[model samples]
Target: MNDSDAINKYHLSVERADGQTDNLVVSEGHQQPEDVASTRLERVNLRNGGNVDYQEFALEQEMILKARGASKILQVCVMLPLEGAYSMITPEGEECHFTPNQGFMFRYIGEEVTFTLPGHQTVRSLGFCVSLDVFKRYLDNQIPDTIKPMLQPKEIGSLPVPFQIDNFMRETLDRNLQVEAQGSLKQIRWEGTALLCMALVEEKLHKAANPETFSLTQACKQKAEAALELLMADMQDPPCLADLAQELSITEKKLNLIFKSLYGDTVFEYLRSIRLNKAKNLIEQTNMAMKEIAWTVGYNHSTNFSKAFTRQFNITPANFAKKARKLTKVS
Candidate 1:
């Protein structure tokens, strides 16, 4: 169909919970429609007012997207809650599943194929589409050819981002949408696109099925150590594995493995040790109440903290504090 005909055939609009209004214009037959697609390539703030519920599917359908035959490269940014299972089979026959708290990427080369969103499960997601040519110009050959395949016929899933990164990306997208209403910033848009692509490629490369993984390398170990130190450095807000994993750009499973191999304890156990050690120092130096000390050591309930303390130090927190006081007084 001609551009005018294609435009007439397809109805492109900005849809929100309250209503739908015309925002995006794609001439029908200009491109094959995507199974699920969203973007604000022209207007930035186009996504500022849309709410889509958790989608669940018992069965999957074929997913395909045909962009207008324009030789423009497209970058699609998607954000979804990591709480359910999602799988994608690439045109090349590679199939994979991503568990909760993870995200993946898929690239297309204007081919038509079946894209499926399984039923009976719910996830909240936001997808941003960009022209591929724009992306190529932005990276200027810094993007590896090996990585270029990611932009076409590839499936990425089950990778988690640090909460900070997740929040940053979400906020950036939101802000871009808002700014787009005022005007489009091509540089800023390109930067956002680049960041998303870098994150996707970095996550994939780190988690590749190889023995010499990124997290296992010495440099990565040092980086992890620095991150762990920062996390424990603030005893008041001790970090959780999930939070730390996001910051480190590795999965919780891999973090556990690395911590066990290097520190001889899982991340949880290590935090407990830190808390216990702090409690011991407090017991020796101060005549604080057990409950008070427990609170100071990152525990809300004294009873549970005391049990954990005893398990680690071979004595109740109260008794340890008493003995510690006596030792200090005598000394």
Candidate 2:
């Protein structure tokens, strides 16, 4: 099969939020027998044989809704609340919420959940599911068998991990809901959306499992790399911390933090190291005098440069040049 076909076949199976919104409909139809307000849940199908959903629903009054009947499936879920204050109580008495700007994910199986939503509030939430097997694959099954069950908290003990929903995820969810692809492209679009969400879900799950893991987001990394490029471009006259941070639209303190995390050195120290390394290269590769080499690498005086070179490389600049010359002759 072609690549597109293979990808489509995977069919991300992006399930709607546990409670149907958009065009999704629950098994019991419009209102549960215990109904107090209007509700609509519909399972939408993509044209290319893939299933994706876009649901927007609301409770007309202040009332409790039983999420659904007990199920026999183990699943991982992700949800984002678009508007209003959404609240739910899991079967285990865990009172939970999904507010604006926050992402929520949890694991459960065949258990009922209750929505304790506010009155006259419309709930627009997007959620998707990843099977346990698929989730384990992404995590390399390193999840100890002992802790597998604990991945989803026991009844009354769901340790739901709350994280900030990044821009990429928010935009993707919005586009997936609004996108209307044509012909053969619809399934691929659906699958792509599903695949991206799965990746995001896996990443969040990894963080959830490893609480100590520090995620260096894309935005911060880009800024740090840009700063490095600027410093490398002109080692003889590197930018000062304040100026460099301003160019990168970051605080000087944040720039240093990024450098320390990525390179194990502060901005000043990193710049010094760069100058010393450049000086060593020029010393070995050129016939420049010690003072010239020092100037070339941003040091004002040969004595200062020699001190730093010795500290960094355990050899004086003159001695390094002599050793480099001897090596060239021997070769």
Q: How far is candidate 2 from the true structure (C-alpha RMSD, Å)?
A: 22.3
Q: Which candidate should be chosen as best, given TM-score against the real structure?
A: 2
Q: Runs in model 1 with CA error above 4 Å? A: 1-83, 91-93, 112-121, 128-132, 145-257, 260-331
Instruction: List the global CA lDDT of all models.
Output: 0.47, 0.59
Winner by lDDT: 2
Give the per-residue lDDT of model 1 (tens digit) for 175-261.
543444212564455345445544554444444423233346896687568667966787767777788888878788778777766
Model 2 per-residue lDDT tens digits across residues 1-331: 5432222221111122344332112431122222323444433333333233434545444545455422434555566654445676766777777664466666655455766555444555665544566556545777643235635543534446565554456556666756777656765665566567656655655644654324567888899889989988887788888999999898887777777678866787777788889888887788899899898888887777875675466455776788897887788
Model 1 lDDT at residue 209: 29
TM value for model 1: 0.36
CA RMSD per model (angstroms): 15.4, 22.3
